[model samples]
Target: MAKARSAIVSSGPVGFLPVSITFFMAILMLLPIGSGASNIIMPHLVMISIFYWLSSRPLLMPYGACAVLGLCIDLWLNVPLGLNMLLLLLTRLFVLNQLKHYKGRNRAVHWGVFAVMSCGLYLISWILFSAIHSEFWPIKPVLMQWLVTAFSYAPVAFLLGRLRRWAW
Candidate 1:
């Protein structure tokens, strides 16, 4: 019985669960479900996935995967090339670096960290976009996006946790 249990536990990565989940998230972000106004408040689903997976299972979610998915998001959103890629890569790094602080902590800590990181990422993006266009981009939409993404993090993280348990 011990041998059987160990075998089952050691069965390294049963499938492409991590990448597929993150890809599904990227697809969700790409879907044109709402009007332009609606998109302004769209949650950063891909970022959420990257952050969750990195924190939960860094081995399964690598920097290369984040970069690829970010590129897809950048292309889909038609933003400056590599914008999402940069953000996603940064997210992976940030989560990894800060993982020690939150690894054994409660979900609330994770949510708080996520909220702060999401806000920072959006602010950086807004700055970059403004610099690229050489004009002051309105801050309202950025704030809306940060709020939506921060509030949505808990539910999304919960769902991802469920997926991780089921898959792993």
Candidate 2:
């Protein structure tokens, strides 16, 4: 007798999903909003996607890929070099380490963890940028950025969750 395949976790790597998601994020980042006023926060898009894949399938989106994506974001956004890269590495490590906590967790739990991770990512980038630029980077801006990033997390998480549940 032949066996049936499940919709969850097809016979392939997670790199494909993260790659496509990250690419989509980069495009959204480039889109100009309201004549360059109050643009959408996209850095967390890739990060959230990366964190999802990293937490869900750490073997697929490893540290190297995370580092590369972070470097790309840094160069593309003209932010301080190595800052995002470091955060990417750290995020990957955190997810990889905390995989057990995510098992069968609720959506709010996952999204909340992503938001907290976003805060970490933003703080890392800010500290690195301030260290290099020697400018007064206030906590409020970072807090606002984290809040905005938290807002952006829902759709991506929902889509990813559905994809994991309904796709092969």
Candidate 3:
């Protein structure tokens, strides 16, 4: 009988490209784009990176890396610890589960999946924030962030695709 493949065994060896690119995206996201209020609409560059790499190159962007990146984001954003960790982890899981269905599909279909995933994740963030504060947080900002992030995915993916190609 063929030996069953475990998670670590199935994934290819980790490398510098994925880690560096993801962290670069994270730093870009953490930068001050504008005034404090404007930051609310800042696209989630790091999340987009995570989603792209997880889908396009799952072996390179493992769950442990996702967790670490999320923790770093949580620290940078000053939100409750583990919030981003949870988000990124969920993104990893969701993308991996749906990989076979969407792999090699049309770009538009990938974008649609990303849109839906971002919407759900943002909604969960809003709900979690409200629960933490014991009140409903204004969801307009959350919605705006989601809109920006969803719209930004295509270009970000394009750039990362180039980087991925270059690295190999």
Candidate 4:
């Protein structure tokens, strides 16, 4: 029992990378990019971080940590409560379920998969917001955000892969 407890305690340091990186990304998203359209079209840094960690190191990120980070993002961004939390949780689940197939795949494959998933995520967000407001939200901004997010995945994933190596 003592050995088991120690083993669990030892995993905490390893787990710190995903949580810290995701939290840092979420905080960074709060920074002002620019005044009008630029801000609306900015990539979802936290979402990218979450997906990267979920794909590459699901054990490190874990569902609970993702939930907390998502909630933090929702509160900080002042969007509808639980919006990000649901999205992150769903993203994590999808990535985890598909991880077996992704193993041994090249970076290009990963990027392609991320692009599709990110688009779906943005679409879902648009639907949710429309439902909440009882009217259809303009999708141009969502499309722009999705495009930026999809294009940004490769570079962000590369950086995150480096971070994972350093952490390990």
Considering every candidate listed, which one attains the maximal lDDT? 1
lDDT of 4 by residue, 1-168 (tens): 987864574487766777888888888778877877544455788888988877766677778887998899889989999999989988898898888988679989888888888888889999999999999999998898889889998888899899877865
Off by over 4 Å in 3: 1-14, 36-40
* 1 or 2, greater by lDDT: 1
Count of backbone clashes, every candidate in sequence: 0, 0, 0, 0
Extract clashing residue pairs from model 2: none
Q: TM-score of model 1 relative to the true fold?
A: 0.89
- Computed on alpha carbons, the lDDT of every model, listed in order, comes to 0.86, 0.73, 0.85, 0.84
Off by over 4 Å in 2: 1-15, 36-43
Weakest ten-residue segment in model 1 by summed lDDT: 6-15
Candidate 1, residue 7: Cα displacement in angstroms equals 10
TM-score of each: 0.89, 0.82, 0.88, 0.89
lDDT for residue 66 in candidate 4, whole number 0-100: 78
After superposing candidate 1 on the true structure, give the runs of residues whose Cα lies further than 4 Å from its correct spot.
Answer: 1-15, 35-40
Tens-digit per-residue lDDT, 27-141, candidate 2: 6765666546655544467777787777665666767777888888889878877777888788888887777887578878878888887787788777777888889678887
| Residues 1-168 of candidate 3: C-alpha lDDT, one tens digit per residue | 233433333444435567778898889887676775654466888889888888876877888899999999999889999999999999999999998999999888899999999999999999998999999999988998999999999999999888777755
Clash pairs, model 4 backbone:
none
